[model samples]
Target: MRYRDENKVLAIREAAIDMVASDGLENFGINRLAKAAGVSPATIYIYYKDKEDLLTSISIEEGVKMTRATLKGFDPNMSFKEGLWVQWQNRAAFSLDNHKSAEFFEQLRNSTYKDKMLETINDEFRKNMGNFVENAIERGEIERMPLEVYWSVAFAPLYSLIRFHNEGKSLGGRKFKFSEKIMKETFDCVLKGLTK
Candidate 1:
């Protein structure tokens, strides 16, 4: 509440993310988030006209941030296998390192998402993903599967890994930290099956 103006807005967003990650979006009433953010509910009203407006803003902001983070360290010109490997590693590490963002995405995966918010969120990631795959296929570096089919195969494995870790699954009695080894293995298996 006492932070600088920009910082307060960020705190509101962060608090909203935490609330949704912890309690699910259905529980994200403005009063609840404002209290969690240590601001008056009216303060939230000042920044957002309503709860849906707040959610739309959060979804767009977080979605773009996640998309940017996912693309970090990915080489657009690498060999198909190498690009896939790096992408997997980057994507998993981004999700695991930023659990709230990961959880926020997981929540968005369900169809219960409000239509307008979901459209904005999906558009952010889907465009990058579509372009990446389309470019690879156009160059004959990757398989010719339909875009949606390719997306499903590419994202499914990583989704499982993230979900398992989020659910507190461990390996060999140790917690399953997202690692290069896991990313490499996942990428190898997926790309091998998808490539000519």
Candidate 2:
């Protein structure tokens, strides 16, 4: 029997994410990931049932980390606009701070386990988020709409910018300059349309 250090597990998780990001899921292989992580394939099997299972676990972990970062310093009782700005700031900071992890998250969004990972987020975080939405609606800060719509309206712009920024190219392949100014302006534009 051989010891499986937890760091090796972390390495495996990160390497798997990097592999999928660079190679796409179709080209991702456990053998290649093992070499990248400096661990054997058997070590990965010990932790995850299979490639699908490993990707699922990584998806869950990344979502939780990003969710937690987004929730920190979040106060549902704040003025509606302030709360929305805070959430945007948190999200932007996370995306900028963890470039590789954010890219991995982008890849996971297209994975088969995407919905499963989203449906299984931390219960407390989910509940708090629900409460925030409900409270905002009750206060008439936002229009009556499904949570999905709210999520799309609020975070979609930031994510769109993050994606392009991460790739260092615009959707049209033009040179693009990214700045905090653009993010704040984009948030204001989205917020104005969402508010009553």
Candidate 3:
């Protein structure tokens, strides 16, 4: 087996992220990424054979980073409501602060066909959050349903809100105004739907 060059791979990844942020991923290309990273185009080919390979790699990296960030500082002992609210707020805060990352993730979600490699990369995130959902159900705090359903309830709405904000949607007349109160309310609503 060949030893993967970590520094070269990292450079290409970083350059790809920058390109995606500045211009949408559609505008990103291997030649442009190589130029941005100060490496030969062959270097990019060495790391990733094509644009799809690079994009899959980028999606996986961003997914892992966002998953860790979202689950950061979560306390296992907190009440289900409190814990869920904290999770919601954490994700919302990350989305607002890192719009580019959020957009990139949303793009991946909207893709028609799911790549196996990308799906494997997203599994850790599902597993982590599913643990929390399973625990809550085991304690009779929430209804016993498929973890995917619970995840959709918890996260899809938040993702939609982030997309709305990114598109410059006006939230005027909204009582929560995208504050803690809003996060709490949204979490509570999701909990109500999930709970018995």
Say which candidate scores most in TM-score: 2
lDDT of 1 by residue, 20-90 (tens): 87788777798888889998887788788998778778887777776777777765656677677767777
Residue 35 lDDT, candidate 1, scale 0-100: 84
Q: How accurate is candidate 1 locally (lDDT)?
A: 0.75
> Cα deviation in Å at residue 183, candidate 2?
1.2
Q: How many angstroms is residue 148 displaced in model 2 relative to the true structure, after the best TM-score fit?
A: 4.0
Worst 10-residue lDDT window, candidate 2: 100-109
lDDT of 2: 0.83
TM-score of 2: 0.86
Separately for all candidates shown, the number of backbone clashes (residues 3 or more apart, or on different chains) is 0, 0, 0
Q: Give every collision pair in model 2.
A: none
Q: Name the 10 consecutive residues with the lowest summed lDDT in model 1.
A: 111-120
Residue 186, model 1: Cα distance from true site in angstroms: 2.1
Q: Which model scores highest in lDDT?
A: 2
> Which is the better candidate, 1 or 2, if ranked by lDDT?
2
Lowest summed lDDT window (length 10), candidate 3: 112-121
Show pairs that collide, candidate 3: none
1: Cα error in model 2, Å: 4.0
